[model samples]
Target: MKVVLINPPHTAIGSRIPDDHLPPLGLLCIGGPLIDAGFAVALIDADLSDMPLNRIVEEAANREPDVVMLGHSGSSSAHATVVALCGALKQRLSDLIIVYGGVHPTYHWDEILRDSPCIDIIVRGEGEQTVVDLMRTLKAQGDLHAVRGIAFRDPQDSAKVVETPAAYMIRNLDEHRIGWELIDHSSYSYWGGKRAVVLQFSRGCPYLCNYCGQRGYWTQWRHRDPVKLAREIGRLHREHGVELINFADELPTGSRRMWRTFLEALIAENVPVLLVGSTRAGDIVRDADILHLYRQAGVIRFLLGIEAYSEATLTQIRKGASVHEDRQAIQLMRQHGIISMATYVVGFEEERDVDLWRSLRHLLRYDPDQIQLLYLTPHRWTPFYKTAEHRQVIQTDTRRWDYKHQVLATRHMPPWRLFLWFKSIELILQLRPKALYRLLGHPDAVFRQSMRWYSEMGRRTWLREVFEFMFKTVRVREGQSLKTFLGPTLEAREYALEKAKPANSARRIIPLTESR
Candidate 1:
């Protein structure tokens, strides 16, 4: 069977930031299982390749795949591109089966099935085993209804939705296959200009921060066996010659037992690799030894979601910890000689301009190695979504939903002004090279950090950007003129809209594997 897996072009939301990061690791995970089942598999990371929609369709038509599989990160706007691409594929090859999978499909499967007639199956939850089972069924001409964790449209009516029972999560990690050969390491790099290859040590997040869909999706934390994870890391380095790894798991620091063992395994393997990715704040402090291990295990940096400084806001968001903890975590990482990248959300509900300033002041208190300020995104099916719906706070369109563009108007502040505020602050941050240098000074640190910033920013290009956004753009907030944009609303606006939908539809195929 010939199967083509695609990471659809993501122009709708992620395009604002121009760096084409790593290929969709989700698709790569599924690719292994399909290949193991004797299916001819090809992966097209359209997001990285920048392939035109028509060109993608034409290429698949040329391949004449038995099954044309497309994957997405569940951004509704981006999903539209996937839908359009799938529709085009179906038009070109009517007999070809089309499948979709990812975060959006797990919760919104019924809606996706109802809306997208082009998609044949929606694989809910993890893709490794589910997708393999799907391909096997197609190969044997078996009943599609028997496949677990799949939702499909009723053929007889084409109006109703049918759902299979939940697919049991895979517990034994060794049974799963990681297909590294499908990816060409030379083709990928991290969004921030590191030549990075990625891996997942665990699946599922246990925390219930209201702003996140991760905890909601997996519902329970499940980790890959430590030995298997270490072996795979060794394999990625040895076989692929890839030097950098981003552990794209929900939280690599989640397990004391698993993380410690995995670290020891990697140490024993003696592979020199630079690892980076997101980790929770509280978890970092709780596991200081794990942080030490991460440094030894080649973890150069970690991006932690601090979210907010106000305890009231933190409690409102159900972050399970405090803002002080967020700072402590960064300090701990710094102490352990790991660079701390702090990510915060601004413009959450009831957040005024004053509140934004407070948060920014709070953030600067840590003197983070790097700071990423993002607008709060109220994605579909999250607790934030329900709350936004109840408050009548959702934004209306594509422009407003942009992560860079503030979309929602609060009772106190206007949305566009909030956007300008964030842009202005971002501009200042971009331009304050001297101020940043002073704050981040260590002779080697200053030199290496500046080079990295310059490399990622295209040699003072970020400085140029600061001048343009700051000088050219005029922002009006509640009809008030300000010298610059504000910061508290810089991140925590709960009414924020998503650039893409994360809705999961029926007929998505998950990857599966049984043979070791």
Candidate 2:
């Protein structure tokens, strides 16, 4: 069977630079089983190529693949776009077997397939084994109902039926190739010309954040062998010339001993790579030495889920951290000279207007290197999703799935207040001299360059008006190409739209299973 794996275009900084990004790990993990089974396979990283839907459709049509698999991440816009992509492809190519797999699909599996006839199957939970098994069954012309971890529609009847394909746990990390051959070494970078790649050292999450869908899948956490993970990073740097690597995991620092060992190995290898990913703030603080070792291992930045400031709100949201602990972690990351990208949530059910200000105030006080404020989204299958679904939290348009651009209905605060508050905070942060200096590094030279970029956008006033109009309406103009608004003028606007793209562009082996 000929299979095509894709990483669709996503929202990110739109600077043109040489790509030295990681390959799609999820696609390749699934691809690994197929390759062993003697199947023809190819990967299309639309993220790396900046390919539009039409281009994606064109390429898939030309290849005439038996199965087309696409991956997505947490962002709603990206998932919706993936659904649209699958729908469009199925429309053009009736014989094609389109599959959707990712974090979003596991809980929303039936919803995705039922909503769109274009999607024939959705591989729930981990996809590596499920996808391979699916292909094997399809190749042998067997009944799909027999597959375990995958869910597909009932073709014989109008009513949709689902199936869970058998699950295969990957206990041996070294057994898989890591799909190094599938990666195109030349095309990846991060946050303005920083050469970046990602390596996952583990899978699954042990704790449940009410907003997270992970709880619906794996019940506990799992770790890759420390030695093997370290070796993979060393190999990428020594053989592939990788300069920066983001260890993409639910928590890269999940296991303290394993994480420390991996860091020690990186230090020993003397590989100059910037390591970045999400980590439990408490883990870094509890094991300060491990963090020091991380700094030595070129650990640079990490995203922390300090989702709320109110203790009641935190407990309500199940963030699993006290205010004191969260603060300590932020301070510790600072002491370690590691850049902290803190994420805060507004629009929670129990949150008040005063609470929103207090959270913002706390953010300003901590003043991490950067902060991202997200209107709480109850993605499907999450506890929050289930609760919010019944309470009228669903936003008006699916386009609002771009959480940055639109807040669907909120639990307490009006959607407009949430939007205005975030917008105000972003503008204020951008205007801060210290923030600007950090953003551009060198003031005079970079400031002029920044001005030029803004000027270019101002020149495209009509386009800018269209974008602002869309934000106002929370509806995209009929036949509007989102690409035109991807850069500076539409910076915040596009962030939500483009972020809809999946993250597998940087690392080839992370399947939709892990990311979604």
Candidate 3:
């Protein structure tokens, strides 16, 4: 069997810019197993390539693969683009089978099957073993329903979706290898000119942040061999010109001892690739003494998820840290010359006009080298969704589900005013003399170039958002918006989260594993 997997060129604001592109590591993961299964496979990162749909069609036609698969790790926002790409592919090759797999399709497989005839199958949850089984079943003309971890329409009844039970997550990370040869390294980059590739030290996060989907999707936490990971990364640096490695892990620092060992191994190699990742702020505070291990191992940046400044908001989201810890983490990173990116999320029911200013004041006091602001996006599968379901969606289009869009109703302000408030907070942080020095006058040219590129992207995005808020008319998906272009009301006001019971509080006494 022959297969071609496409990381569809996304329509998100980030995708529109060439310098902002990152390689599709998810597609590469799926490609690994398919190659191991002895099926001929080709991977196309159309986003990095920036190819038009027609040109993608031409390239796939040349390969004449028996199957074409498309998916995005960031699924909710990329659904429309995938659907459109499927339609174009079906039109071009009448006999081809199309498959998609990701978070959104994992939950809404039935809707996708009923709505789009072009998509033949969806592999749910993790894709490694599922893709291999799916291709084998297709080649042998076996029953589609017999394949685990997939959803497809019954041939006899097009309206009926045949969904196999939940796929077993792969507990052993080493078995799933990346098909690095399938990717052209020159096409991807990070931190400006550093040739980069996305790699993973672990899967899943242990913390129970209510709004997060990673904890649910991964079900448990696991890591790869520390020495093996370091050796391969060293090889990629020495042999393949990979100067930077972006970790796609949610919690790479879960096991502190293992993390330290991994760092030591990489430092021993003395290959100075810029390593960057997102991790909980508490992790940094825990490993303060070993901060030198991080710096020695080439960890140039850590994006601490400091979702909010107040203890009230932190408790509400079940974020397992306090404002003090967040500030300390930032200080530690700065002391070690590691850039700390403090990310704050806006748009909770209880937040009011004063809350924004309070947050701004807190951010200035905490003062990290970098800061990012995002609207809280409620995914249906998350506990946060129950509280958000009744709220009106301002940007009803699935494409806008990216964290950039404000999805919930505000208590005290309209959408435009809220956006203005958000922008104002951004300006207060990034426009400061200290922040400007960190961004524009950093000692490392590569890091400086990256910060400037992102600054350019943000400036354009902010202006575009202002234009949309003032001029563009959006049609809400369901409930009526508070205004012609904003969100609907959350019936329950002044609500806050109770302290969480414990880890796995809602589950049976089963160990956190693949079968959860």
Candidate 4:
């Protein structure tokens, strides 16, 4: 059997930087199983390729595969693009079997199947196993109902949804292959021109942050073998010319002892790749004793999720970390000479100008080497969705949900005013003297050049987004795409904060360490 896996191009114009693109780990992971299962597989990373949908469709059709699978790493925002890509492909090759899988697709299967005739199957959660199973079943012309972890419309009765049993999660990470061989290392980079590839030390998060869909998707927390993972990074650096490793894990630092061991192994190998990923602020402060180990292990940057400064807002979102922790995390990262990138989210239902001011003050006080201001992305499965589903979504165009764009209509401000305030905060924070000095006047050439590259990217993207909001009709309130969206929001009660993974409460993998 032949298979084609595609990572659809991003919908938002400013969301991608060509040189800094990372390989689609989700697509690659699924590709791993397809190869081992003896299927002819071809990989297409549309975002990095910068290919238009029409071109992507043309290329996939040329492959003439038995199945064409589409998945994404950061999926909620890219749902619409995948749908359109599927539709276009279906028009060209009416007999083609199209499969869409991701966080957004998993939950929105009913709607997608009903509205879009193009998508034939949805490999619902943890797609690595599902993809392998789905492909095998289709090749043998077996009943799809026998394949677990899939949602497809009944062939005989279209009104009914055939949701098979959930796919069992891969417990021993070493067992599942990661399709590193499928990626072209020359296509990706980070921190300027350093060649990069995406890797994962672990999967899922132990913490319960209300707004996150990653946690729900991953089901539970688990880590790859420390020694094996370290060796893989070293090998990629030496053989594949991968100089930077962008981690796809939600939280790799869950276990202090294990994480420390992993770092020591990487440092022992002496790989100089720039390692980067997002982790909770608490982990940064908690790992203070071994701070140097992170730098020695080539972790040049840590994006701490400092979602908010106010205790009330933090509590409302169940962020699980206090403001003091956020500040101390930044300080610790700076002390170790590792760049601290703090992410602050806006667009909570109750947020106002006063909240933005408070956040700005906090950012200045924290003195992070970099800060990213993201709008709230309330994915359907997340707890935040219940609170936001009924509210007016101004940027209803599915692609604009990329944390960069404001989505929900605010209670205190109109769409235009919110956009203006949002853009103003970025200008004030990033254009200040200290930031400018670091980018332009730093003594270290490497630091200055890297900072300049990143700052320029941010500046250009910010400007693009501002212009988009002002002139792009795609984001206008009247131009919303969700006209069929009716009232009653999905009811989501909080599962046991300490237990019960979403959907599959029967089977859950408790992380060896959640205490740290």
Candidate 5:
């Protein structure tokens, strides 16, 4: 059997602004197992070159593969694109098998199967093991009902959707290696054009942040063998000439002891690769003693999920961290010579102008080396979705549902005012004298370059967003409610978590004909 994995191009500013690209880690992960299982596998990273939909269809059709798997890291935002691309591919090749998977499809499988006939199957949760099993079953022309962790159109009645039992979580992450040979290393780069790749030391988050879908989608927190991961990092550095590793993990430092051991092992390997990733602020505070190990192990920066400055908001979202700890974590990282990026999410609460002002003031006081302002994007699978279900949606287009865009309407402020506040806050934060000084005059040359590169990209993105907002972007005045737009919530259908339930338990499938 032949398989071609497609990483659909994304419209997010981050994807468009960067001069370099990172390999699609998700596709490559499943590709590894398929290759080891003796199936021919190839990767067409359309996002790498931002290929057009027609070109993507042409390329995939030319390959004439038995199965075409499609996914994106920014699944919700890229979903429409995936649908269009798959539709086009099916037009070109009528008998092609199209499989879709990601955070969005994992939760919204019912809606997808009902609406998108171009998609043959939706692989829920983790796909490393599921893809292998699925492909083998397809090769044997066996019943798809026998495959776990998947949803497909019923053979007898194409209108009906059948979701098989959830696949057991792969207890050991090292069981399948990434298919590094799938891509040329020289083409990808990050942190000022240094050859880079996205790697994950762990999966899922232990914290129960109400607004996050990661905890539910990933099922539970798990990590690769610390020493083995370190060794793999070393090998990538030595053989592939990878200079920077952008961790795709939600929280790499969830386990302090395991994280420490990984750091020590990486240091022992003497690899000089730069490491950058996101982690909770509390984790940084917890690892205060081993901060030196992080710096020595090539961790140049850590983006802390500050989420909000107000204690009330933090408690409301169940962020599991206090404002004090957030402040302290930034200081600790700075003291250890590691750059700290505080990610402050907007719209977590219904913010008035005064609230925005207060949030900006708090951010200035925290004094992180960098800041990322994102909007609160509620996924149906997350707890926060239910809370915000009654709110009016401003952006009806699913493509703009990425955290970069404002989705829900604000009762206290108009869309224009909210956008102005966002731009103003971002401008003030980035143009602050302290941030400017670091971008131009940081003592470490590497850090200086990184800051400068980020500033340039941010500036471009800022201008592009302004242009789009003024001329291109559209928002409805009186849109449908969140629940009405997204349909019913699917929080209970968490596939990975369902693995622990009894076999005789009720199936989690919800048919399209059921009342919303």
Candidate 6:
């Protein structure tokens, strides 16, 4: 069988503001297994150049592959583009098997299959092993119903959707190698032109933050062989001329002992590559003693999920971290010379003018090296979706569902006013004297350059967002409630963790036509 994997272009501001791009780790992961299974596999990263739909279609047509798999890390926001790409590809190659996978399609499989005739199959949850099984089944012209972890149109009734049993999570992440050979190393870079790639040390998070879409999708926490991953990173740096690695794990430091071991192993490699990734604040504070090893291991920055400041809000969201830990983590990272990026999320709760002011004040108090303000984007499969089900949805367009854009409306303020507050908080946090001083005058040249690079990207993104919001974007004044718009929640039907339990103990799969 022949296969082609494509990373569709995304419209998120972060995707467009930077000059460099990272390899699509998910597609690369799936590619590896397919290649090892003796399939003719190729990768077309449209995101590398933000290729147009016509060009992407043309490129896939040239490949003449039997199957084309599509996925994106920014799944929710990039979904519409995937649909359009699938349609164009189907038009060009009618016999092509169009497979779509990602967080968005995993839970919304029924809707996607029913609405988009171009898509032949939806690979739910993890795609690595499932995709391989699917390919083998297709090769032998066997029934797709025998393949686990997939959803497709029923053979008897095209209008009906059939979801096979969920695929078991990969017990060991090292079972499949990443198809790094699928892409040109020189084409991808991060942090202002340093050759870079996205790698994962672990999968899933142990802590359950209610709004988290990743935790349920990943099923449970699992890590790769620490020494093996370190060796791989070293090889990429030495052989491929890669200088930076962005960890794609939701919680790389979920296990302190494992994380520390990985740090020590990477340090042993003596590679000079820079590292950046997100982790919980409590984990940083827990690893305060070995943080120097983190610096030595090339961890220049860690984005702590300081999603909220108030203790009550933290508890409500089950963030599992207190405000004190959040502040202490920032201090510890600074003391160890590792940059800390506090990710403060807005819209977890209804916020008024005073609440926004309070959030800004708290952020100033934390005094992290960087700050990323994101809106809470509730996914249908998450527990948080039920909490937000009745709230009015201001932005109906799925393209803007990225956390950068506000989806749910607040009773206290209009969309314009809310956007202004969000922009103001971001501007104040980034342009504050403390932040500017470090961006311009930090003693370490590497840290200084990193800060400046981020500042420049943020500046362009800020301006573009302001202009777009004022003119290009549209928001409904009196939109349908979230429940009315997205229909009943699918949390029960799609959560991977629930599906992993014993058959008798697991919740029964809800029928497709049943109302929640």
Q: For candidate 4, list the clashing residue pairs, or say none.
A: none
Question: How do the residues 1-516 of candidate 6 rate in per-residue lDDT, one tens digit apiece?
Answer: 889999999998889888989999999999999999999999999988889999999998888999999999999889999999999999999999999998999888878887799999999888889999999999999988888888888777776778777878887899999999999999999999999999999999888798998888988889999999999999999999999999999999988888889999999999999999999888888888899899999999999999987999999899899999999999998888788998989899889999989999999999989888998888888888999999999899989998888889999988889899899988998889999998999898889999999988888999999998999888898999999998878879546633353553211233445454
True-structure lDDT of candidate 1: 0.67
After superposition on all CA atoms, what RMSD does each candidate show versus the true structure? Answer: 8.0, 9.5, 6.4, 5.6, 1.4, 1.9
Each candidate structure's TM-score, on Cα atoms with residue i matched to residue i, is 0.84, 0.80, 0.89, 0.91, 0.98, 0.97
lDDT per residue, candidate 5, 409-461, as tens digits? 99999988988988898899899999999899889887888788888888988
Backbone clash count, each prediction separately: 44, 33, 0, 0, 0, 0
**Ranking, lDDT, top scorer first:** 6, 5, 3, 4, 1, 2
Report the C-alpha lDDT of model 1 over 1-516, residue by residue, as the tens digit.
899988888753344344536757778888888888888998777777668988998878877789877776635546667778888888888888988887756665666676677888888776788888888998999987777767777556566666676666666656768666677787776635555676778766777787676665665666788887787778777876666787877787788888889888988889877777888888888887667787788777788887777788788888888777888888897777677777777756657888777766776676676666676656655665545543333343332344544444466666555655565655554346643653456455533563365345533444443454456434333431111111111112222212233454333332221111
The parts of candidate 3 lying over 4 Å away from their true place are 18-20, 440-457, 460-464, 467-516
Query: TM-score of predicted model 5?
Result: 0.98
Off by over 4 Å in 2: 10-23, 74-76, 155-162, 165-168, 350-353, 390-394, 410-414, 427-516
Off by over 4 Å in 4: 441-446, 473-516
* Regions of candidate 6 where Cα sits further than 4 Å from its true position: 497-516
Better of 4 and 5 by TM-score: 5
RMSD of 4: 5.6
Model 2 worst lDDT run, 10 consecutive residues: 490-499
Strongest candidate by TM-score = 5
- lDDT tens per residue, model 2, 374-444: 66654544556444444342334554454444434544666556656765665554456755555466344
TM-score of 1: 0.84
The positional error of residue 390 in candidate 1, measured at the CA in angstroms, is 4.1
